[model samples]
Target: MANEVVVVMVPFLAQGHLNQLLHLSRLISTYNIPIHFISTATHNRQVRIRLHGWNPNNNLIQFHDLDDPIVTPHPIIPNTTSHPNFPTHLQPYFNSSLLLRTPVADVIRSVSQTARKVAVIHDSLMSYVVQDVCLIPNAETYIFRGLSVFYYFCSTNMNLGRELPFEPDKICQLPAPGESISPEFSEFIKLQYDHQKNHVGNVYDSSRIIEGKFVESLKRDQVNGKYHWAVGPFNPVEMDSDCLDRHICLQWLDKQPARSVLYVSFGTTTTFTSDQIAELALGLERSTQRFLWVLRDADKGDGSVGVKAAGPSHEKPLFDNYQTLHSTCRSVGLPEGVAGRGLVVREWAPQIDILGHLSTGGFVSHCGWNSCMEAMTAGVAVATWPIHTDQPYNAILLSNVLGVAVVMRDWEHRDELLTSVMVEKVVRKLMDTEVGEAVRKRAAELGGEWRKSMADGGVTHEDLNSLISYIHK
Candidate 1:
């Protein structure tokens, strides 16, 4: 009888995590392992809409949705740019991880009867609960850190006492840029770690659990244990060019001058209020730099309080120029002359092609993991503007540690209070400053390093193969 393998992926309630887990599933399923992707009901709807058209019902790939306790209380928040309700209102899903473990375990048990073994890939932030659940029979667990190798390297070496990884209080000598992380960025790193740590409870206990798991996995690898995998990002077992789209932004990019355009996006899951949108717009315009901005539509939950049909419409008047915008797309509004300024404001542009374009010189981004990876891979320097969650942390590492990026600010607010002056300063620095040039050079070099990391017999490739071998043992 052929041995079967079942893999369970439990990700945080965020788009970045969802994308990463799905990519991992795609990689492992190629080995003929049965993969079951688990997510909440709302997230499942999102997957169905965005990724469903891509063909998900193949023999090896399947998806499942679990119950969400706060479903009714948490109405779906729509994103004008990316898929709807993605990263905006992050419901308290940490409390639900344990609640989700049983249903997931039962699914694994049912699949394992016909399969050879079972594996669980847990996002690093939720590793504690996922690992606990994996004490079940034939189940192995691994933590997936959705960050770059640079950030990972910095994190592994952080000590919170004498020297915090990113505390502003230290005014001491800055850590080396690109070669090492500076104290300026370390405060944000430490803050992000604390935010995640708080969700899991006492830091000491959490560290103990994490350390113990690593030690056990190392020992298992020594004797070739059945429950160990150190996989990071995924690679196409075969690079089928046909599987990718080729003609959209690349053709446009082939015509523009190098280092002239700024690529702008807030990521698939993050959302901002209309005021914040205007502030950002003014910033972009005042900076006098040409850019491609992906703007999210207005969120209607707050205004939809009592009206049945007028949901987000009630709040539309708040935007001064909205009267000019037709509801043709799920947009809040576009300021006058926005279309004439060499700006591309589409909901979704061919990102891969755009990034690959020679004309695309820099990125003004939300510092999401996938975006960071894509930008680095494209050799594009970045103007980092982080919002919520791990974005600030990622921004710090990218700007201060790697020297490939520059941060606008680490603070985020729902109100549209930031003046146009702030945006002008950031935009000018990204487009014309000497700092920007240095960052661009370093980014190009790192992009090459990233390609090397995933090439055959590279660090990431070896890691993935070792993970697969460890699990099959």
Candidate 2:
């Protein structure tokens, strides 16, 4: 076709990351470029099954399977199963040390020669691999922060020591672009502060703890002497490509007034206990605000002790409290007026489309970067309630600093359920007063700028063109 260019996306095997990268790849492929989505066999298989097939039009797009030796005892080929949970499909990928210099160098040597040129768009968390991957003469690597433009700037500025620029030895009240960041109840800031006290300098570096435990094992693959370029997502872009669903959520939006609907989702991965779900249901019921929610069958306990599937991993079993209450819910279920009082629950949702709807004024999000990006681009203010990982950090940035998102009840525990009163209070504030208006105005302004950035002569548009140019070089 138009000088085939291969764009390999290496996400952290989570739905949030996968969704964002897939969207980016679709954006590139729309320009008539070929995309050979190289992912672990298990994940690729899952994609095929979920989408019914990889190629819908049978045009310039295709999927290529890669072998990870460490996946199973078979190394190159292993049996993968179809599991309900998505992360289970990623288990095999966790064993391969793609970040190690030797393997990465080998992968480049193998793939680089196949295409006229190769461009690698990797997650920022996988920065260690950029060293070796970018070394190939024809290779150019990009670091996708996948968060907000401002958050990216903050992360880059947040250094480790005197040698670094803004390294805090403790939970210092660091300043944002325009305001002072207050730790308050942000578990992210609290944890970062705790981390600083326990381990000074390199506050962002959690290599030792996270490695082997998660994809951090990839860090072992870093090459010895290689230069890695770090580029932040400081430039915001509204992904308005035709690749997105156009009318999925518009009808729903047409029925609601501006700033009335509260969007609630805990992202693709974060699940909740049945009790937590009940609490959340009760909360939404109490709030009396119109809402759309994506609810998954997740428990507060570990269920991964036995099942071995090829798809996403299941959450831990429910806590003891849920074990007893689960039966109760099974019998009585949701309150009688809950559904009619303005709540629509679904297993899966047209998220990107929903956020962009004009009627969607506020989001109750887990603060995943992809969700944040979508909300920001759509001009929807957020109601932050982060669960784990970098979500807490994202939530803090959105609420305390950005002044766009409002925090509900800080991260809740199984024992500490978020009551209906807390939910109603947050929802009322998001819908009724000046604070809501201010947040809405800020989000709209930000979204408008982002939309402009992706136009023909805009900053993000130029950045994308430059990315293509780099690949051709």
Candidate 3:
């Protein structure tokens, strides 16, 4: 008998990247195709622990954990007057991740031998790990983008020889007019860009309904002869009963009126100074709107890499530094008066569950693409506070192009502390004003359109089918 075609997924170590590819894996598995998901042991465990939408154990996807890479310490420049705009703290993790290329290549080679064709789908940043797949006669590689297609188009417009429709400042990934990039982070970016040159096709965690104009624009502008698929809003439509019961926040949400509570979270990678956190709390208290906020210290080490042996020497020291900077953030207490109307979670909150709840009226988000998609799909308006990377671009998409969100703080002002008065103003506008009502209605309409894109004959459905058929071929 002929061996069946096999699909392999390789995601970057970050939670956002891992979660998207895992969701995609679940979607692809429904077609009866066996999938092998390869990653470091720690990241695989993290994804498994936090997995929702589907039960991982019952799925057709198999987890293959690779040995952990040895962690090396990057030199710390003490008393530096200027800090890099990028998250240079993650450099050690990035340096170690590069070592996985040999082992990842081995996994792909071994899996290709047993299958008629091996389709290796990797995160955009992880192309280096699977670069050798082209040498395998029966293996093909596809780059999975975790950001919105619109952000991709805008970021690459100049390189693609297309004139930008918006001002250069609008692309937040680029530095401000006078700002300078640190050499350390600049090298890191250059390395990632070099790794991206080897993919055969592109896979986006976005839908035509969300970015139809950009999708068509990219198709016409790029002459690379590579196929692009917009298969997204990968998050499941409804949370299972078990998932609902697991999070206590949902029970509190049950008591609130529909469209009354604001859900606040800044994603896993963002950290705030104590004064900023205090101002945020004061603002929420002053707004007097019912709210649910997820507050946690940013992950100090590599976001997801778990060292298998004893912790690296640099790990504890780096964590110590984070503690010093954010010590007040952890202990700064919210006012007693706000407790009656607000709920604050110090651990991971069931973000998707909370966003999908009927009580959730608006989201105060960092505008991460995954969070943006979840909010859009749930028909919730957003109060954008974009921090870095593609977040500013996503904020623009929601607040400007989509008209489903309002900007609380733009990336240009990320370093400045936000005062309580400003916070109260934004929160009240999102919750009590007629403008808020209009934004909510638009969000619901867009959400309906996004859902239709995944229905039986919708654009996303068709694109997903096309992807699977290509794998089978």
Candidate 4:
């Protein structure tokens, strides 16, 4: 008898990457494909906790907690121990490949011999281990990128070890100019870009999950030579109860008029300097619009949120930014809301749910690919405020290419932050002007188009089917 296709998922340790894989795992399981969701001890627990009721008893999906007692006999899981050292510094993409080397090969070998036809689906960052993963009998490995297609395309095109043709100030403006990008910024992008050099265009030439013709145009490789498939805009996965407080946020939305409230959130792992936060606070207040703001103090960067060229070369620049921003954010105090129309939430909020609500007309976002996808898929217009990494690239994509979002603040390579004036102006423009209405309508229409893309015979659905056929072949 032919065995069922069993996909083994090995996501990196980041929440953003893990969340995407979990959602994708849920998606593939609908086809009755069994999955081996593997992670280190802590990450395995995190994923299991995320899927609380989804896979009880492991009937269809097996959870491999590599850090669990049975799998990890050692008293301590090697990578689970973390210190004040930030993630961007740890360089896990490079280290994790080495760490999972034997474990990944062992798991695939075990699964293939006994019951199922195994396929290894890992984070794009883990591409270094794909070659080893492919060593398993009849096994195939595919890279799953959690970032935007625009960001990916830019990375592939950039010349490593060479100066960009554009000005250093125009790093974010590959096709057009908006913000300044530091030399270190491109360095990080290059690091990620270089990882895919081995398998990206050659290995299943997997499809990117982003959905849009504009992104499609940037395709550098032949139809399937590089991007064999387009897998998304993956619907924003719902957060588990532990990750968010839904009832309070949803109840607040229930009382607002349709498309009247602005839903503001940067992302799960991102925080700004206090100055930027204060500017945002003032902007939200000045716009006179009903809004929901989800804030996390833990993510506040010391100004430079993890863009480093090497050891500590980039620290000083970031530290300077943090000090300036801290004083500014500290000096200002947010006023009480009138009639309790607006709300400020410090803990997590159900971003996907909040964006999808009828009352959410606009999103004040940091333009992370997932958040941007969520807002666009929900047909909610965005007031873009990109902070770092792929965010600025995504902001450019939304504002310049798709016309679904309005860029609130241009990204910068310097020590400056967005002032209240910029924030208030953009908020009012998004909430009170005809331009905002047009963008809002366009967002909804784009959302409808994306919905159609997910339907039968749609481009994304076809690619998904192609992946299935390849697996079954």
Candidate 5:
């Protein structure tokens, strides 16, 4: 063990970024490599808690707390939730990352003192890591692309103004009709590359596409001398947590017929207007299909859609909470009489377990990368309702290119919140009948292939070995 290598994993503060990177780290540990996971105290504690729950090989995984000197003292808006007419508040987080140069660099220096090869694996969004972490004398730096391979292709070429086949102005969907992006794709490219110049690291993406036609297209891209190393779609298997009643839902699911239930959840940051949530709630009820929806209470804070102020004229006590809203669901637009068919998971739901259940047939998701991978890994086809960021693009991949999901609405499709009537139709198509059955079979087949591909002699397994070899050098 004298020559054992140690790595540092630095994920952006967001929940999605942390989850993916943690899984990636766990996967790396299976090869018997040790890793030091670094983040703010709050986030590191959360990761520690989650890892302890998984009961993995703990000796290989260590957590370090980095103090955010700048933002620790400053609380900009009293409210952390997303609000109308307020400026986007992401700049503060970016500022905090830049300020971590001292503590993070010190950690690097301490690790370099040991008799081991050291490397830093960081989220692409962390501009400071590229600026500072690479400066550490002997440690190599690599970026973990938490986004899809599709985004990587678009970001690289689009930065070079390489005349992409798809129009940059429109939301870049896959095969057929699709949605649009914010700030547009081209602009997004320039801003990112500006921070990425002169960086020291290899690029690693979470995409599972490297084994498919995407590999060929990626080869073509590499001819231009820009390349990303594939060590992923680092899919998570068997999630367990103290957050919810892990057994109740699964026990209830066992009684349902095969492919009978649809699982619905938007990731942590996703939110909807009251009108939209009501429409969605009623849609589940009216669809008459067994479903589990994790409509968490908005009052918990963080960025989520909030209800508008009610006028004095309306006698109804404005619906401020999901639990209360559930009680009088009819007042807020749920269809009458369907409680027995659906369960509202307000605490937390073991997402991976639920997805893997035989009774779970379909997913109605916001098309986040982690959620998409989970559904694919579990062989559950999806009903896409993308909300923002890279989601519209993810939806296209699932519904169009992969043929594993069907898009109900792109992220920006907001003429008005979709009515319950619209919801029922989409749910039915995803859960019951000829089209759903076909997609379900396709998803299962792909899942089997992906699992095989991650095993011994598989594509990702080899790529991971290559990554480790690269770090050793």
Candidate 6:
């Protein structure tokens, strides 16, 4: 019966979204179902190269590559400046994604012919790609939300003209739909929103242990009797050998004391101004904590490119490659004395491995959902520094509701420059103070609960079983 069903995954073209759906595909494939993971050729290649925790060469999960869409070059904003327009710069990418509708529909149709039931699961933002799924008699469509149920609940309430039960901070209050995006992108967003209204249900990269109340609230408040499932912290429980070999950060982490090092990263979509980077560097130094910082520019959709390290300064830096460390320190304008205290990586780091390592105590993050899930699963507390989109809401959930993180800056103040003094204070608060310890303890407890939820007979496992059964019926 399982072999008579096929799952088709259509993930949005960003790292966070792509990674979650890929993890979902793996989970679904384990049930003996054939899975088709479709995306542009370039994106498929990117997934293959960056995939960890599992081999992409598995027989049950197959990659279906669509031709790349012709997109104009987006303007390259300098790394030294803040991106005020933010995601508007991603308009070209969004526009290009719409062009995949026909090809995606074609794939769904072809697969439906062989399978008794074709399950089309798409990222919420990519719903337009599979809008025609309803036209196929044997196919059903589901939306995959790559974020917390808490964020979605609040946002949906606001969109429906319902008032929030509790007062929210300015940053936590979500912007109205299409308010912050380009007109072209706004139209694209509308299409997805329209298509979402007719979907069967939602699949979240979240779990009840993290947001049980919110999940229940969404279920009760849903108007059409639609159902949803929380089967997430989508990263695998066991680390594969391939993940261990991907980065030098893991080797450096090996020498640090347990619960000592801070892992700092702003995700793939966020980039700090040069001044902001300098302030952060100085702050990490003043806090006197051992840190591993992944510093890179926002991905521009072309491909990953290495950032050039600058020349050496007077102080000696700590990596195996002294020259590279010295150059990284000089480039980021770190204080000479900070050389031995930190490691700055210019490319992608194995985040899952780093977080899962015993030495990692806290995270300085943009509070993207994927990062939040990774930190939670690894039992590391966070210093929340949200940039845009649903991040502010995730930050609020982490700091205000869950009590697993500390707020470094509010989204309302994201445009203002954060000074080194404030950075040092926040870093110290999250790393050296009693407050930090309390949050760390709570985070560890939550991590334990979430892990169990993924075990047999737990909430996540049952949810996965329910979803598979739904498809089979």
Best candidate, lDDT: 6
Encode model 1's per-residue lDDT on 223-268: one tens digit a residue.
4232333344342222223444543334345556787888787765
What lDDT tens digits, residue by residue, belong to model 6 across residues 180-202? 34476657767887788777888
RMSD of each: 8.7, 11.2, 5.5, 8.6, 5.7, 3.8
Instruction: Quote model 6's TM-score.
Output: 0.91
CA lDDT of every candidate? 0.55, 0.50, 0.77, 0.61, 0.63, 0.79
How would you encode candidate 5's per-residue C-alpha lDDT over 1-473 as one tens digit per residue? 34357888878866678777887788788777788888877666554443322654489888788764444322222111243211123434544555665777788777777736777887777655445655666676776777767655555565576655655444344322212332333243344555565444444544344234554466675544543467665656555534464445666677788878898888654445555666777788778888977664321122222222122232122233323233322212222365456776543456777888878889999888878878887878999986655676678678767889876775444344677998999998877778888988898888887777777788866777777777777
Among all windows of ten consecutive residues in candidate 1, which has the lowest summed lDDT?
201-210
What are the per-residue Cα lDDT tens digits for candidate 4 across 330-401? 211135443355775544455777887778899998777778877877788999876656777788778876
Give the Å shift of residue 182 in candidate 1: 26
Runs of candidate 6 exceeding 4 Å displacement: 1-3, 78-85, 167-184, 241-246, 305-323, 326-336
Model 4: how far residue 264 lies from native, Å: 1.3
Q: Give a tens-digit lDDT track for model 2, residues 1-473.
A: 33456766555444555455555666567567766555555555544432310233446556554554443421111111221212232333333424333544566656677776667666554444445664576666655545444343344344422222223531242332322221221322232232121110111111111111222212222333222221212212333434534332344556888767888877655545444555666677677777766555321111121111112232222111222112312211134554333534333455666776666778988777767767877778888776544565567666765567887845333125576777778887887668877887887887776666666876556655655655555
Better of 4 and 6 by TM-score: 6
Q: What lDDT score goes with residue 150 in model 6?
A: 79
Better of 1 and 6 by TM-score: 6
Model 4, backbone clash pairs (residues 3+ apart or across chains), number: 2
Ranking by lDDT: 6, 3, 5, 4, 1, 2
Please provide, for model 3 over 1-473, each residue's C-alpha lDDT reduced to its tens digit, 9 standing for 90 to 100.
13589889999877888899998888898898888999988778888877766788855788999987777644332112244434455567666767889989999898888888989999877877777888899989888988988777876775456667876555543433224334664565567766666577889988888898998888886787778899887788777856434566777788899989999998766655555666787798889999987766544444342211112332232222221212222222245565556876665666888988989999999899999999999899999987667777788899888999988987666667788999999999989999988998999999988888798999989999999998898
Using TM-score, give the best candidate's number: 6
List TM-score per model, in order.
0.70, 0.65, 0.88, 0.76, 0.81, 0.91
**Candidate 2: regions farther than 4 A off:** 1-5, 45-58, 67-93, 96-111, 124-137, 147-159, 162-258, 298-334, 344-346, 411-416
